[model samples]
Target: MTDLRQLRHFVAVAEHGHFARAAAAINLSQPALSRSIQALEANLGCNLFDRGARNITLTAHGQLVLEHARRLLAGSRALHNAVSQLGNLQAGELRLGAGPYPAARLIPIALGELARRYPKVRVQLLIEDWASLRRRLLNENIELFVADCRELRDDPLLSVEPLRVRPMLFFCRPGHPLLALAEPSAADIAAYSLAATQLPEDGARRLQETLGREPLPDIQCDNFMVLKELVRQSDVISFAPEDVLTSALVGGELATLPPREVLPRKGSAYGLVSRAGHSLSPAAQALRALIFAGDVVAQ
Candidate 1:
């Protein structure tokens, strides 16, 4: 049976490229560390290293074993973390991913509630586009994410639960020319350059249907902050979920165009998405529950 300790020793040696340094790192005598590596190679019936007088390098077989060894060690660590956090949400870490819009609007409230409840629990959030968040979740870089449920539906590896429905609204800085119009046609809105957040395909379809045509935004950004800034400075019309501009709206920096009645409330839904079959840590689950409870599914 291969010992995990021996694998650790091998990894340390491979990383350091010197037995003395590796032994120091692992707090073992050089001879003991060397013996451990020898035992590992002997058990596998192969020379795991091309040991030279100056430095050592992994042999072809060593490289193969190193990859698997690293994976095994990583899995072991994950298992240990899961076990440690099984029932203890007070001290463990919670890692979450979200797109810019959700990160800006919904996450702050849920996170605030989480912090109020479990002050010791550490929370890490990654904000990016859906594609980036999806990749991070698939890689286990994050425990879960809040994003477009539509994107999560296409991937078989992810489990999704709908959290909130946010309607799309055309907005602009206060006193923009569009606000003067009682009911602006699609062409009227299209006449001015617009900036908007990147929408999923379904969201794009909905927007097109609402506009009665496919109106291409002059600036398409995944980050809502960028669109908000563009709308604030330039005459560019901003189009995105109402939540994305909640702060700006509250601060009186931005306002919906063509009146609230003209805006389409049939917008996108965001959800809690995690890798299928992967267990979340206790802190993560706690945060998820908090967010779900607070989400409230807008009418």
Candidate 2:
């Protein structure tokens, strides 16, 4: 049997591509870390690392083992979280991941609802890109994620339920030059710099496809708040889901460009994505339900 500690060490080394750095990261002495890897490789009857001239690399066998190790580790974490929350949702932490847009709208509502229903449950939100969120979900870094379903739809290891299908809208600060025209052409919109928040490649690609040409983004940010502030203060235009702009629009700080027909009607659908075959904690379940309910009301 492989030791979880050794597997963790291996993952750290592989991630950093250097043993000394990995040792420092995991707070283990370099020699001790080396011995642990040696022990792991000996037990498995194969070398896990290729100690080459320039950079440390995973052997072919190490690559295969790394995948299995990650799955096993993730399963162990899920089991632990499930067991910890077996009782009433009185006290257990729920780690969640979400994209910038959904995080802005959904999390606060769900957190409030969850607090009302389960006051003792603690929650931590990890706002990240779709790729990082998926990786975290698989590795058990997050209990669940709410994000666009473009890539999650086909992933065999994960399960997703639709939350909302929202249309993309262009936004600019009130009295923006672009809004001066009744209808701005693609060229007209492209003339000014555009800003966007944390868009996945597929989402960006789809937007480009809709425009029939690539328009360079002058500013790309990971947080919707930052992007909103940039758009709110500057003449920069932004493209995002309607729900994401609700507060700003309602507050009269931002205005949508006219002629919605010019843009693509179909946009991304976001949802709850969790690892398949894993049991979610009671706290996670409650939060998921709240999210689903809130999404329905929003729709």
Candidate 3:
């Protein structure tokens, strides 16, 4: 088989139309470079060049081989770049999984920052429950997950970094019964049905643990936009991330409970967590570094 180095030498010589100059450009002696091209031609069973005592000219076969050789060299350089830049935070897809509301905000912000710096890299997003997200990551379905750290509970299969705290806000249609109250207690609001994401296990447990009872939602789904829509149409209430609710609040489609001193600014502490011990692709790691470097700060 024609070796990559051999093809490289042949293509360089073809482009420069002179072996001596090609060898000089590549920091090799002309004879050594000639030998490499000769080997490549011999392996391919074709004469790639017609050499005079002083100058080398392309054979008809040289034109065809030169085309393929240039392509091979270009691809080889691309392969090298793809591998090298992985560490430089420059390229590759970041498979991301996240909770809907947080994902709505964090994913957009992080991806925008990633795009500005590494525009060539792509991002694939999926919103799912923590259990499903964890499962997908273990199966190599995703590279990173923006998850609520509190839900992770000491699993050795993951690595996490805290991003920001999210505070939960209750939402209801304007003039809903509980909204009229000066300060409604959990029970007062509890009288009305709860409309929550009802995420599998993890989110469910956190919700019940907070309210001291399993919340029977008036509606449930994994979509944040749908959850907001439910609150806008009826008296349904959902505790959602502040960022996701921004447009709704501004449009008079929803409202918040006064900030709870007990809840964090981020009612839930969400972070970027990797699956177990898997090392990230160079591009993914680069994006992670920029994300943590405050480059993607809460935009």
Candidate 4:
């Protein structure tokens, strides 16, 4: 079979119409150029050129081959260019997942930056609880996810890169009865309706231990903003990372319940989670960099 190198040599000799000039143009010796064309002709079972006293011309078979060769070479160049674009993050798709918190806090910032820098890159973001996100990742529905990693850290099938820890707090509307207490105990806070997004297994266990019962949300929502609005309108108490409530806290739309020994001070441990041995695509790597950098900026 004829190879690209041979076809290239054949095309060069055809264009230049002389063995010596074609060899010089292609940076090959005359003998090497002649040999490559000869091999191509032998492989194709047809003569490609007519040799004259001072010049060479293409035979009918050579004309057909030249047309096909140019098309093949053009297609080869296009394939290389597409691969280069993907490597540079200039063109590709990023399928990513995020738990409620990071979807609300971290992902938007990173996605904004990614869009600004690489407008050609398409993104599909799935916002779900950690367990669902983990399932999606393992099932190959997404490249990676950002979520609470407490349960996932010990999994032998996963690789986790922890993000900075934030503080968790229960908050309600400013004049909610709990804030009137100097320090409300978990029982005191639990008396009222509790609202929250889905919790990780460890988080639920801690909540159960603290409240002395199976923790159930009166209003469970994956969207924190909706939960925040609910908290503002009613006496319901909700817990979230401190940063998620920063605007509400600053604007006096909400106030945190005073600290109690029973409540966990540490927030959810968010991280980047992927299959242990799987490699991330270039687009995923670029987005991951922006995510880490956005975390720094948040701090």
Candidate 5:
């Protein structure tokens, strides 16, 4: 029976400690504000205020009601704000995940655009391998993720939307021995240490077949930056999406190995992944649009 209006009146009176001043602050006449508070107290069967000769104070019951009223009002305001944000994309959060390659190559550009367009929308990005990202998405830790989705394409629990495919390339430091060979064989390249992030299942199988050995990087790292530095300083060869190697290649810090018959020139099958049948929030939708747009432009 008690309503928000009555609670507001009660809070105003409690905060001001004077009926006249509280009524003036709320643009209500003193008698009307008093009646509202009286009705609230009557509905709850308690005296919220103790009226004295010169000052008014909250009784024990009044203090308890004030705490509950503040919390309720705060929750109500948050609900209204969330509703408004859903319509306008003016404020909200986007929880996103990305595989190492997409995190390093694709996400930054899209996130930059998202930041410029919706400054109030908060973003939380988790960079991991595709399998880890899949777990996070299924657990509802992230609303969506961008990653190599070849393995997830047939997953009933996921919805995958393909992005522009990017060619993968192997690179080594400029003066590496592999670069000296006019045409390096898979065995020639594999003679030295290999470095990379976690490979997808198919990629691992192909590498194992090509090298005729175990498909494991001698120097495994999740971060490309670290892998790049390692390759630049050592005889380690590494592979990554072409875009991720652009800077190093352009600067001549690294050079790609000549395409070998044994090694396939496979491109990444990256996509946007989300839980099946789950709707994205407005902020997530906005970022998703930016990501798709950026992917098109990158092509």
Candidate 6:
């Protein structure tokens, strides 16, 4: 029978590309590691490596077996972690992928509560633009996701649930002309230096039509903090979730563009999304519940 220990030795050698290195990695003597590999080859009735004096190369059969062995080892590890330990949230890694907007507030608040509860669970957050975040979800790099509904992408293996909605508002630095001056048309907004999301033309066509011009934001960015800071430092104007900059707005950080009767931009809804087919772990489920349940770390 092909022993699991021999297979581990074979995998270690294949991965390191050198028997001496692999032996050192696994804390086994080089000759013992070689013997383990030979035993494995005998069990399978085939030599696994072509040791060409300078380096080692795997035969076709060896390549195939190595791939399967790695997969089996990974599966075994996952199974052991899942079954052997239950509800010990702090022991494993939790990866959450979200666009910049939702991550701005959601990540800090959500993670704060998670830290208080599962202090040992390692949390990693990946922030990407709408386009990239969608790709990562499809690639299965992240288990949980959240983004604005306007850019809500649907894949057969993805499920989305509507979360909190924040109103979008246009604002500029405190003394910008847009505030004290008469209500200007979308054409007027285009005339000034504007900072906003780098949305594709087709996706934001209606917004463009309302603005009566191609959406040409002079300072295009996806980070709310950076965008808000630029507005504070410069006379730049921006349109974003009203709540995203609530602290900035209240603390003399930004001033809103007067509500316009001529052109009404509607509020946008942000949704909490996850990979459709994969089951979420308890830690992920708990965080998701807190997200929709409006549980946030009190500011």
The candidate scoring highest on lDDT is: 5
- Comparing 1 and 4 on TM-score, the stronger one: 1
Residue 154 of model 3: what lDDT?
77
Q: Put down candidate 4 lDDT per residue, 64-111, tens digits, no spaces.
A: 998778666644543543475565677766778998889877899899
The candidates, ranked best first by TM-score, are: 2, 1, 5, 6, 4, 3
Model 3, TM vs. native: 0.63
Residues 1-299 of candidate 3 have per-residue lDDT tens digits of: 87888887887898888988999999999889978887887788988889888888899999888776765665564455457565555554556788776666767776787788778777788998666787767655577787666667477988877776655777787768776777877666666667776454555655566555665555777788787778778877777777677887899878775434322133666778786676777666766776666524653
Model 1 C-alpha RMSD to native: 5.7
Off by over 4 Å in 6: 1-85, 200-203, 260-265, 295-299
Candidate 1 residue lDDT tens string, 1-299: 79899999999999999999999999999999989998999999999999899899999999999887876775675566567666655466677888777887788888998899888777789987787888777656678888777766867898888876777788888988877888877767767886766667766676567566666545788777777888888789866777767778899998887654444446657888988888777778887887787777433
Candidate 6 lDDT tens digits, 73-101: 65554454345336667466666777767
Tens digits of per-residue lDDT, candidate 5, 1-299, equal 99989998998999999998999999999999989998999999999999988779999999999888876765464455457568667876677899888888789999999899888877789988888999867655677999888889999999999998787888889899887888998878778888888877887777877887785667778887888999999999888888888988999999998783455536878899988996776777788899999899887
What is the TM-score (0 to 1) of candidate 2?
0.82
Clash statistics: count for each candidate: 0, 0, 8, 0, 0, 4
RMSD value for candidate 3: 14.9
Worst 10 residues of 4 by lDDT: 73-82
After best superposition, candidate 1 residue 235: deviation in angstroms? 1.1
What RMSD value applies to candidate 4?
A: 17.1
Question: Whose TM-score is higher: candidate 1's or candidate 2's?
Answer: 2
Candidate lDDT (C-alpha), each? 0.78, 0.83, 0.71, 0.83, 0.84, 0.72
Candidate 5 clashes between residue pairs 3 or more apart in a chain or in different chains: none
Query: Using alpha carbons, what is the TM-score of model 6?
Result: 0.70
Alpha-carbon RMSD, each predicted model: 5.7, 3.3, 14.9, 17.1, 12.5, 6.3
Clashing residue pairs found in predicted model 4 = none
State TM-scores per candidate: 0.72, 0.82, 0.63, 0.69, 0.71, 0.70
